[model samples]
Target chain A: MLQQLSAQELPKVEQEMTDFITQYTTQEDLKKSMLYSIEAGGKRIRPLIVLATVQAFQKTLNAPVYQTAGALEMIHTYSLIHDDLPAMDDDDLRRGKPTNHKVFGEALAILAGDGLLTGAFQLISETTLEPTENVLLIQLLAKAAGIGGMVAGQAGDMAAEHQQVSLGELKAIHRGKTGALLTYAFVAGGILAQQPAYVLTLLEKLGGHIGLAFQIRDDLLDVVGTTEALGKQVGQDEKSAKSTYPALLSVAGAKDALEQELAQAQATIEQLTKAAGFQPQVFQELLALFTL
Target chain B: MLQQLSAQELPKVEQEMTDFITQYTTQEDLKKSMLYSIEAGGKRIRPLIVLATVQAFQKTLNAPVYQTAGALEMIHTYSLIHDDLPAMDDDDLRRGKPTNHKVFGEALAILAGDGLLTGAFQLISETTLEPTENVLLIQLLAKAAGIGGMVAGQAGDMAAEHQQVSLGELKAIHRGKTGALLTYAFVAGGILAQQPAYVLTLLEKLGGHIGLAFQIRDDLLDVVGTTEALGKQVGQDEKSAKSTYPALLSVAGAKDALEQELAQAQATIEQLTKAAGFQPQVFQELLALFTL
Candidate 1:
């Protein structure tokens, strides 16, 4: 269910992003810089989650939902661009492509990230979503992507570098760095579907569990996956002395944590199915994406 | 009148910013970094314009308006923080104090700017205004500050550095770099007052003229003002071969241009006064802010 829905909706999501960037960005150079990152392409997991959550509701998918998904992708992309900047990760490669700064130079790269982040909000505002929905979406996106979420998470991550951190602290970092925006995708989908408040809460918890599972998988991948498969360096956490679930819990223990999160997520899906009319199959399929 | 209103209302704007940041920012270090830039004061001209514009219509000044004003200042502050980055302007001092990057290091500084920019939208979202008003404000802000406006302007400015540019080209750069967000102040004001579409149009024009005037004055100050008064080095534009109003048009020419723009702004104010029941005295005083 998730596969078919993603194949169908992801292209629409990509089109909206492309069209939005082309129509709004005026300068050729800036346009190229922005399009470079947007097109650089990842699995587009955040947008996929958004589309999947919306699809699970069985609502007639529409432009506003696509725009929201695109906006989410933009935020995710901008974070990646900044994350790779010399001042931060200092990474020269993103998904085997030269990082944005490597191609556009640092100034344009920073501006590109700034443009994408700001444009995400613009994209949402331009959506034909009801004003109330638009406002709520913008507010939630800002909160998730802003200091309360990603920024704070990043700060904490940077601070924790070169030092050992406990499991609770590690969870706090992942919650903001990955969880906040990831959770936003589900909550945004629920809002678009106009689900009840309780369903939104359930979706939030489900997103949280999935976020932890996703991070643990990522940490596991870094340790066990080959560099080529990851499309970037593996074991970077060890090189940078960055803390991760596997680092703190050991690889076997980390696998247990991942299973625990997935189990909790499955239970949440059951609740969502009962309360919000969600189809469990789609969520189950989506959950498998987190598993090894 | 502008002075009295600014004196009375500017602190309220400051308080709103402080309160909002304190309430929302979760991490201690992140909060400190965010507040440092906000507290390193400048003229507060943008928020003053917002407040003054709203007051011109005799509308009740409410929390939404203050939130809107506070959001404007946050956007402005974030721009300054990013502008001073080593990747951008590379300034070490802002308002006679160490820049955010200088004090907090580059990674945290970048995140601070990101948080502030995103927080601006969240601040507006939390406002008590009608959802339609909130949506309009967000749309206008994202356009004025995003790739289409300030980001594009900064990109053009960087591209044009150390190169001769036509007056038309220089104006184009300023339109994005400074004019867009400045113009947003007036347009947002008109939106909040529930003015007619035509009134909003007139306010946009008024803002455009004022923006040009402000940029010219800044250029003139760069050429002539003391380091003590400006709180930073002067003549840095010429050192960088930055194409400014003075550089492109000669000092006297730039002064004439400033006067011309101010006259046009006054004319716009007259039209606004007639069309939207705006009081000209408030606008006239606001216009004076652009004069040297």
Candidate 2:
């Protein structure tokens, strides 16, 4: 179910994101630079999760949903662009392509990332959702993607570099870095679907588990997966002397942790089903993607 | 009157911006970096405009108005932070103080700016304004600060460096880079004061003129002002071979242009007073700030 929905809706997410850049940005270089990164490509998993969560609630997959999803992906893409800057992670490639800075130069790449980040809020603001909903969505997105969430997470991650961290501290870092927006995907889906606060709460928990699963899996993949499979250099995290789940938990223990998170996510989906009758099949399939 | 109001309300504006960072960011490093820029002194002209505009309408200077103003300042500050990066203007000083990157390191400086920008939207959403107002404000802000606005302008400005551009093209670049947010400050104030669309339209036009005046004055200042007065490098624009009003127009011609814009701004303010009974004193004093 998740596969079918993702395949069907992912293209629309890409289109919406591209259309946003083309329609709003008139400056030639700015437009081109923005489009370059937006088109550079990723799994669009954040948006896919949003679409799936909305679908699980049996809500109409409206334009607002897609715009919301696209906004999520833009924020994710912008983060990747900035993270790859020479000042930060300094990676030359992302998803096997030249990083944004590598192609656009550092100045324009920084602006492109800034543009995308601000553009995400614009996209959310332009959503066909009710005014109240738009307000909520903007608030949620800013917090999730900004200092309190992803930015802070990145800062923490960098601050902890070349230093061993407690497992709990590591989880906190990933929760802000990756988990915030991933959690937002589900919760925002619930918001758009008009699920009650309690249902949104349950969605938050589910998203949290999923977020943890995602980071652990990413850590595992970096340690054990190949550059070919990952589409970026492998073992870069360990090479940076950065802490990771696999390093802290060991490969086997990290795998156990991943399974636990997946299981918790599955159990939460069941609880959501009981509470709001949200379809669990899509969520279950989503859990499968995180599994090694 | 503008000075009095600015003096009285600017502290509150600073307080709100500071409160926002403190309340939202839990990560100490992120919070410190964000605050470093926010507290780094500037004229706070943008927020002061918002305050004066509300006051001009005989509207209560509400909390929402301050939040909106603070958001504008955040967007402006973020742009400054990013602009001062080694990859951009490579400036080491602003307001006679070390740049954010100089103190915080390049990576943290970048994240801090990102946090402030994203935090701006969060500040807007939390404002007590009507939900519809919040939506419109967010939409306007995202457009002004994002690709279509400041980012695009920055791109155009950088692209045009060492290359001469016509007056019209130069204006377009400055319009996005500085005009957008400066204009936003006025228009958003009108929105908060619940001015009619025509009044808001007039404010937009007024903002346009003020933006032009502001840029012209900046160009003029770079040519003739001292470092003590400017609080940064003087004559850097000419040093970079960047196009400026003084470069295209003679110094006398640039000053002439500045006077023309300030005159147009006064006319628009008068028109607003006629149409909406908004007081003209605040705006007239605002224009005085651009004078040599």
Model 2: clashing residue pairs?
Answer: none
Clashes of 1: 0
TM-score of chain A of 2: 0.97
lDDT of 1 by residue, A1-292 (tens): 7778767888899999999999988677888999999999889889888888887888778999899999999999999999999999998888889999999999899899999999999999999888998999999999999888998899899989899999999999999999999999999999998888999999999999999999999999999899887677788888888899988999999999999999999999988878646777778888999997
lDDT of 2 by residue, B82-129 (tens): 999999999898888899999999999999999999999999999888
- What are the per-residue Cα lDDT tens digits for candidate 1 across B1-292? 7988778888888999999899988777889999999998898988988989988998878888888999999999999999999999898888889999999999999999999999999999999889998999999999999988998998998889889999999999999999999999999999988999999999999999999999999999999999898777899889888888898789999999999999999888878767646788899878777899
Reference-based TM-score, model 1: 0.98
- lDDT score of model 2? 0.91
Q: Which stretches of candidate 2 lie over 4 Å from their true place?
A: none
